[model samples]
Target chain A: MRLCKKTLIWDTSIKWLLVKKMFFILLFTCFIFDAPVAGKDIHVGKDHTIQTIRQGLMKAADYDRLIIHHGVYHEDSLIIDKPIEIIGKQGAIIDAQNHEVDIITIVADSVTVKGLQFRNVGTTFLSEPAAIKISKCKYVTIQNNYIQDCFFGIYVGNSRHCRVINNHAEAAFKEQVSAGNAIHAWKNKHIQIHGNRVHGYRDGIYLEFVNHSSITNNNSYDNLRYGLHFMFSNHDIYQNNTFRNNGAGVAVMFSKKIKMINNHFVHNWGGSSYGLLLKEIVGGEISQNHFEQNTIGIVAEGATRIIISDNRFTSNGTALDMKGNSIDNQVVRNNFLVNTFEVVTNTRYNQNQYMNNYWSGYSGYDLNHDGFGDVPYRPVGLFAKITNSIPAAMIMLHSPLVNLMEMGEKVFPGLTPEGLTDEAPKMKPYAYD
Target chain B: MLKISAVILQNLLRNKAIFGYLVLLCFTGWGMFLYESQPEKAVLSILQIVLLVLPLITLIFTTTYYYHSQEFLFLLLAQPIKRSDIFAGLYIGLAIAFLAVFFIGIGLPVLLFASGMQSLFLLLSGLLLNLVFIAIALLVGVGVHDKSRGIGVTLITWAFFAFIYNGLVIFMMYQLSDYPIENLILVLSFLNPVDIARIMVIMKSEASALLGLSGAVFQDFFGTAKGGVVSILALILWSIIPFWITHKMFRKRDL
Candidate 1:
């Protein structure tokens, strides 16, 4: 019995020793074999002068730079499942060829896709698959490339801290069902869209269900719809952008805590178009922007607690038409020069502040020369007030008899919106250099 | 003529390839319906597939039918009958056989899911398209001497009508961009059979909003009674041209 017990213990000890040896061997093999998979550089388009990029990216790790040469590389949808830098040299073309549903979908972190041309996407009415779609990704930079004739060019949704800079997107202007937006961002946060030229899309850059993003220095023009559009997006800063010659310049609706600063809104003239159409916008700042040659400059409806200060509005038709049940907003220290109609306040404008703004037609004098007018200037005109209530009443605007009636009403304010006044308006223009 | 059609139809009905295609269509149509959200959803999802898959099936099936019936056609020609009647019988007989399979495959589900006169219209339109395409295939089979060349001509014609035609139209518009040619554009739209059919069916649906406001104007003009008459005439013309050409060629040419 003693000899049998000793033999069993020895057998168990041998089994444990073999297991320990196998574990070490596996650990060593993994550390060595994974080296190439993690940090390898692959060159594309090696045979031709323009290198062909091979794409079967299950994952990208430890690879510093993936260099793609210039050639049309047909791939199905490739997922950048890990972190990597993809650099295209001499205009490499990543043609998905509409092979699969989507193309170059990224769900990884710290990915950079630069200098590539993409086209020929499949269109499914049920599925809006883009050429380069990034979902739930972070620190992704899509910069310095041209994308043309795609269904949707670069779509990023549910992503954070992404930078879409200096890219061009032009869609095929076919049937409306086939054409899609250039850059579509929905349910996204903390994105920076800067210095991109987007044109001839359904919308140039669209932000829906977004928050805390910054759109700066982007030129959005010649699009079918609004140049830069946002809905249900809040606390976002849009500054230093040029939106010109689109169907409509820019529209901000159902949003709050927004800032529009120092942007150029120019020549977006069309039927029912505006430099900025604000609907249901609340608690925002609009400062130092140039609004020129738009049909309507700064159309406001159902917006409250917004500060409009130190902006230049020139050469626009029907500037600042307030059309809804808004209260307690301030329009201060802005220059309104040669606009067709300065202000049209339709609803009760009792609680709103219109002070310290420079109107080029301001006849009030500054006794102290402190840039504040001694007598208060009313920006809302009597004829404008009437026209807002009855759009057909606009026929009475240029009539001398209607003009005399407007002057009489302004002298003794009757039947207009009650207590609409601009106390402490500016005598001199609010200058910006 | 009736006896000739009976013999040709019975032989075609027995073919395994035709049987497979019938099964494939039924399975695909059923799968499309099952996967879709609603009748309208199925229509929108399968519109492109209908354009591509239906024509392909018609082309291949009709071509094979024409080739297989050649020997039988010669035998029938040896008897006392008009060539026109023989061509008509073979063409109509093959069409009836293919239509039976297509109705069982694409039509039954369409009946189950689709609603209103539009659905009936879609069914009739699909059947008419199949007839036209089958007629086109038969014309090619009669025109080309080599079987491969016949198939090639049919495929190239399909490609021209399907893919390149629209692109060429757009290119033409771009080339003539300086001209005030909206009415001309409307007239030119009738030149392509696919566009006419697409516009007709789409105008019937609520998804006409997909074309935005410009399409509304087109619909206002093209969805009228006059437009409907014109479209039907165009489709009939499309069918008649190839048949007439083939009939004319076959009359003159040595077999």
Candidate 2:
């Protein structure tokens, strides 16, 4: 009886082990076949089985490529929720039909929308719509897209590691209140905006609360408002961009640790326009920029610890309108050529330092032949002071009395900002690369 | 009147002082363009010459010429010519000679080197200034009998316009700084032809600076087409009114 009972226990144990082995095989097969191992291309066009982008997206799985063929698609409010690539074939267009909605809304990680034309996302006062809107996404790229007449182009919000590259956006709004910005970014981190051309919008590039971003090689012109506007952004670098013919060229306000280099600000002329308006900015480096024919080249208000060097200011209304609130800023190695006023300020005392600048209006001779002027160059003329106090006195610009008063102020060193002299004014302009 | 004016123009052109003045202006205009790389800046330097040296020379030369040509004027007066015709002939002759010299000296360089609306405005203002100063010189010549005293008055007039008048305007502006004195400033600017000419050129060249801060009144007055027309008319009136007054003096004088 004992032998029979032991054999029964061994049989049950062997059956249990076989059952576990079958379960493992079933799970392995499910892992291998249930989920796609590689991304597959899903075609959408007139001849393809998939008739529309929305249907293709519905049929697609994760890690799939939606290939839009060469045709115009009247689609709006298309939401992209999967980590897939949407690539357009040659001449592929997406027309929103002047709809008051975004053309494409991206909410997934590792998504890319490339080489598409988006048009006619109409203006809306209640909502800020865009041609391509990316929110709450990571590793998204919106590249080589042509957007026209959109409220906003390539708007990115609450995003990380996103890139908007090689996109062109244009609008025809005549008023600033009716226009939106191109390449608008808000609360984004690690954003890269590069090689974009934007015009006729309120602002070419607008940033708010964006950090660790870089904007490079953009041509922004003819905007109704600022070409580039930065507010409350930190640690951003913008370089090699051309901003021209905007209401005001570029305004960087309430920002810190900004590096602006090799940018060109041209032909920004208006009653209150400026090539670069820096307000409440701290700890920035502005170098190697060209400011030509601007109303005011650089206006610094409440800015601190900024190093402005190696810039060229040519034919501006006022080269540097540094207010008294801006302190601890260093202006060095700049060439100010033919500006009406080299430096105009509201206060009589200067807290900022001006050194090694070559002013075209400087008449001081260099007898020592050391390439530095013997006399310290006073940039603030007496007329600048008069205009600062009584703005109507600007009619006296280039008057004989104004010229004589400026000369007298130079000899006497009175009325015009006392400590605002360039100690070592360069006799020759520094050659820039 | 035309024949008399032609003879006087010929005589004035032959004078060495006028020829030397023309040469000096040529040197200054051409040398400025050659010295500065930018045509705008060269125009600015030439503007200085127009403002300061042109007025001084025009004042001194016109006064001296009027004094030295007294015998010729008396001879013309003794003829059957109308007194208005004689006065008109003298004024026209002086205007034509100076205008010719200025055109050849400065206007040619401006056309060749820096040809723009601003430069053309400078040339226009310079010509107007020449006419205005010549009219004032005639007024001095007719009003003051003594030659040395007339020359002194011309010098004082140039100083007052070029220096003291602006000084006084500046003082007035500062004193009335609390008020919105833009229109008042405009009125004062029109009171002096030199200031008017200066403002016109500056409005064109340094427009970006001038329009930004001078408030809306100045912007409307100076930054518009109407401003150009109005300023030119004011300058014309400046030239004409002074000559008319001098003409009245000459008509009523006991020669």
**Candidate 2 per-residue C-alpha lDDT over A302-351 given as tens digits, one digit per residue, 9 for 90 to 100:** 99999999999998989999998999999999999889889988987889
Off by over 4 Å in 2: A1-38
DockQ of each: 0.01, 0.35
Best candidate, TM-score-wise? 2
RMSD of each: 30.5, 10.6
Q: Model 2: clashing residue pairs?
A: none
| TM-score on 0 to 1 scale for chain A of candidate 2 | 0.91
List TM-scores for all candidates, in order: 0.56, 0.92
Give model 1's docking category. incorrect
